[model samples]
Target: MSTSSVVTAPWRLLWRLGLRSSPLALAAPLVRTRPDPDLAPVALRAAGADVAAEPAALESAFPHATDRIVVLVPDTDEDESAWLRHLDQVGGTYASRLAALLDWTPVNVRVSPGEGTAVEVATTLQALVDGWPVPVRRIALIGHGRGGLVLRAACALRHQTPDAWHELVSDVVLLGTPHLAVPAGRTMVPLSRRVDEELAGIVTDDVVDVSAQPLPHARYALITPHTRLQQSRLGGLLGDVLWWRHRLPMRPRKARSLFPSATLHHVPTHEIGLVNHPDVHQAMLAWLA
Candidate 1:
């Protein structure tokens, strides 16, 4: 362990103890809510819910038209309209910006809230790929949070049965995805086990062992935030402990061993929000390119 880890170990323990003393803290599971697969979008739509928009019309602005397509998947409980509005408001014309910066065509996939699971979302993506107007020779799958998990599931399905869409995937970019498992502090686990068996089960089945089962052939990139709120610091530390306990980072490393290459990037940002940062946009542009 590093010197900083050794120094913080005692502090982490104290924080865990303090957190355990609270009944409210102990009541809730440390894991994120299960994604609702029912909300998975049935079809791809323009960012503003313009079903009438043509893919060709959207791609017309690109100076250097290429067969490459970039698909954006939002987090759980989010869809394309909300994602696009947020990106435009904070990211400042991110789609157009990316189009202007790269040769690839950018589009957003609308996923339903509370009902989009990895497998279901993957099916939706596959359908999009099958029906795309152009012959998609290359694709870059960009997902945020749970959406990343969906992409992984899609890749896994493709791996099982090779198809045109699977063959075309050139890049998979995951932003702030907890690939190994969701980080619930060490202290919460014992409390959860003692209090609610159902919560404990959820933590074990859904949070603890959620792996991407990443494809060996595809290039992958994992991006995380370096800066988070102090309130979530203990949870982050405990999450790291869970990672250590399970030897989790090894999953990605193993995937990297099989692929052409894989890269991990940590962008400095507060909390789970990094999509709007100019640095993040630049890094993504560079990576996608």
Candidate 2:
């Protein structure tokens, strides 16, 4: 073996062994800092609702649109305000820049309590869709990270309920979503994977082989970044290996199979912060068109 290969082989072996026997494999729930209760109210307001308001009460805040209704689902552990701010930075406020880009009313949905399993988020989304005051002709869902999984679950729920929301959904956009499984590590994975087996269970149940059971009548798009999870030299190498095995084209390929007509976009970056990238936003706008 070459000198470099000889030196790295032992480390690779150790990593493989660690992953197999690590406590993380047992799927223990990650301990997270308690989110500020105040943030919840802020999130609700950003979504155009009062903290105490019912889902139905928030509907009037969104203008009725015959062209389409666009809903943005933020990443796990993110507040709606953060996403709204991102939207404003990328385009403008929903009524101005986004409205021009999409030619539709854009809405943001806040996942209550701020953090949870995909199923919990999906339940909230279903309620949000059910409570819409205006009829939906065409709907588009844009989700980031675990939010994408929540969108898929919401679609599944719609299938079960036979709602206008499902029938109206024209497309779903997933941004850096880990459809199969994320890289198996604590420091390298996102908050969604750090959650208990709930996240894993949902992904495995819904998308382990989604190509076999794709959502009906809606186009899908998977967008990912070519990013590194680690910065340290040794860690970066390991991260690259894990990323190549887990991230890369794996999730997107699965998505394409699931939705044979699905489109895939790769952003040149080192993280999942695509919301701030104008090119990514433009790509999504193009996809919507």
TM-score of each: 0.61, 0.60
Candidate 1 C-alpha RMSD relative to the actual structure? 8.2
TM-score for candidate 2, residues paired by index: 0.60
Tell me how candidate 2 scores on lDDT: 0.51
lDDT (0 to 1) per candidate: 0.52, 0.51
Best of the candidates, TM-score: 1
lDDT of 1 by residue, 1-289 (tens): 0111112343443343344465466434333454455533533556355332344554543334457778787765566643444464465544566677776777676554343445555665565555556666888887776666566656766434455566778778777654443334455454323222221111232432244456666789776544211223344434422222223554531111111245756654422244655666776677777
Tens-place lDDT per residue, model 2, 168-257, is 778788776655532233435543333322322223433333534446788888765432222222323333222222445444312133
Give the root-mean-square deviation of each candidate in angstroms.
Answer: 8.2, 9.8
Number of clashing pairs per prediction, in order: 9, 2
